[model samples]
Target: MTSVSSKKCNKEEYSFVYGDEAVSYEVVRKPAVEGLSHQKSQRKIAIKVHPSCEVVVIAPEDTEREDIHKAMMKRAKWIYDALKEFRGHLEHVQPKQYVSGEMQFYLGRRYVLKVVEDADALPSVKMTRGKLLVTLTRFNDGKTSMVRTLVSRWYKARAERIFHERLSELVPHATWVEGIPSFRVLPMTKQWGSCSAKGSLMLNPHLIKAPKECIDYVILHELCHIAEHNHSEKFWRLLTSVMPNWKEVKSRLDGLAELYLNE
Candidate 1:
């Protein structure tokens, strides 16, 4: 394999020839694993293909280029398959207009938007009779921006409450976790949830649009990170010990991303 490094890029991204094809992937340097040589670390090189077909390779800072290239080649088929599937999903994603009659998702169920004009009532959003009802005062015009803001605020509020509840319910399963980690709900582009070494958890507010089972999967996944920091075999074992059906739940959660992630 031949590698061509990019000098102008801020990130450590490179283009390489794998077989007859040339591909570009971002390189992220991570801390080296303890008790293992630089080259022999099992996670010295790890690959992730995002829903946008962006490829990233995480490696130890001291790892050689040859090791990264070899690892990428070993996962060539899986990478191509993932890219193809992501491309298919992208083709069907239409931009939302935030208009009346538009479809919205909450907790794995679809709800139709119903906008109403109420001169005496304050602008608000709520679910009534299986549909999302947005009541606005006459002083405010029913613009897309106004509608989006109302809906976004509603989702954020619900996400905060639901995420906390789910975390509390699942904490009992993960006995390794000592104290409850503080959590915040925010918008994230590339991940469902993340945990910091300082015992803080950040959850993607968009996850509220997915099913309860899928939401639980994300919470449990981050909780496992509290005990195991990296995506090592031990991390998977700890996660499996808590939720045996996490694999199936994770697959379903991945499939729901295209529907919720508008941008």
Candidate 2:
């Protein structure tokens, strides 16, 4: 049995061939469980395809090379499907220039970002008449930067308010969850939300642009983590118990990650 230090990752990146494509992936080892343990065959290997189209294999630190290899092989098909879907998201979303007529999303609806430059107008971002109006007074020097800043701040504020409300609304459903768990909005390129072992949550502000249902899904997913902590069978069961149609919602969200995450 090997003990992995929390400060360091002892495993290196690994790759395996799938059909004609040589897929590459990274392995993130979790610390071995203390005292009681499951059999090697029963040991869980959690495979996740992130919004960034990165494949991550998470297994207990003491897992053997052969077990990890077998788990990867078994999940090869799912990995490929997830990769293709996420890749399509990236390929389909048009790059943003932060200019007028650019498309943006708010609560599952698409809106055109109309950059309204006015030397006398107060700098602000407001949704009006099906358009995201970014009014600016200091637009001459850094027009694009200003638009980005104002929009990002607006999204953060919305996320803070919306996430807390949804968390409160959904907390009662997760009977195992104690009170309201603490959460914060911190933008990340790779994940929509993550939970610490201590039960605090870190959510992406980009999630604010997604539909309210999708937002609820992300929040509920994290709330499940409060009890399960790992992506094991228990975790999935807990998640499914609350959001029976979570798989559908997750797919829908993944399909739009490219658009929602675009700067």
Candidate 3:
């Protein structure tokens, strides 16, 4: 089996493999899905796994190959369990049944989606008094994915606006990072956001449901990646310099993940 090493990856930019178990753990800044990276102790490596994708491992440049492998082996059980849960989640994550008065979450608030059909009206979503009103021209018999897609798209659009506003507050000096190209909302099993060395950032729509501080923390985190591609000491030092209370926000966000990730 190939051993994990401290050698810098030229193509991957940043990666780590824990244990000599032959599992290749590589980290790549990818499109937004639904999960966050978890790291403990001294933060030598961070693991971000999407319910639908492979595990990405990030570590400092000086981490030894064998040590990284050992750490990964220690985490093997947890990784296996997480993937199992992800598979179960995929089998059951059918879109919210578009029944009348179905409960749903939007912007951290509870709202009931009341679906109505009007041939003369284009599909529209609006806050009618206090309820969310969805007017569709036709209900394609039991094609729930369409309704769910519509709702998800609506949420993503709203999230973009809210995310931009919040991110602006956190990284006022931040500029439009280029080359990293494209950001979109997708059903992610395990992360809040991602950033590419090329400069693009992918964010989760679930941020709309999280606390403002948590949202800011995620934004700051991905932005920090623009400067330091790995979870090296220098990268964290930079994060601390910018968001001193990041640890608090991180804890809160981690709790939030447990709460909403089941959906």
lDDT of each: 0.84, 0.86, 0.65
User: lDDT tens string, model 2, 1-263?
Assistant: 12121233665577777777767777777886666466852478888888787878888877886777787888888888888878876776886888999888998998999998788889999999999999988668789888999999999998999999999999999999889999889999979999999999999999999999999999999989889988899999999999999998997898788789888
Per-residue lDDT tens digits of candidate 1, residues 1-263?
A: 67677745478888777667677889888878788875577455778887777899998887777778778878877887787788886786778877778778999998998888898899899998889998878534546778788999999999999998998889888898876779999899889999999868999988999999999999999999998899999999998998899987886778668878772
Q: Report the Cα lDDT for candidate 1.
A: 0.84
Worst 10 residues of 1 by lDDT: 136-145
Score every model by TM-score.
Answer: 0.66, 0.67, 0.55
Candidate 3 weakest lDDT stretch, 10 residues: 13-22
Quote the positional error of residue 48 for candidate 2 in Å.
17
**What TM-score would candidate 3 get against the native?**
0.55
Error of 1 at 184 (Å): 0.4
- By TM-score, the better pick of 2 and 3 is 2
Sorting all predicted structures by TM-score, with the top scorer first, yields: 2, 1, 3
Deviation from native of the Cα of residue 247 in model 2, angstroms: 0.7
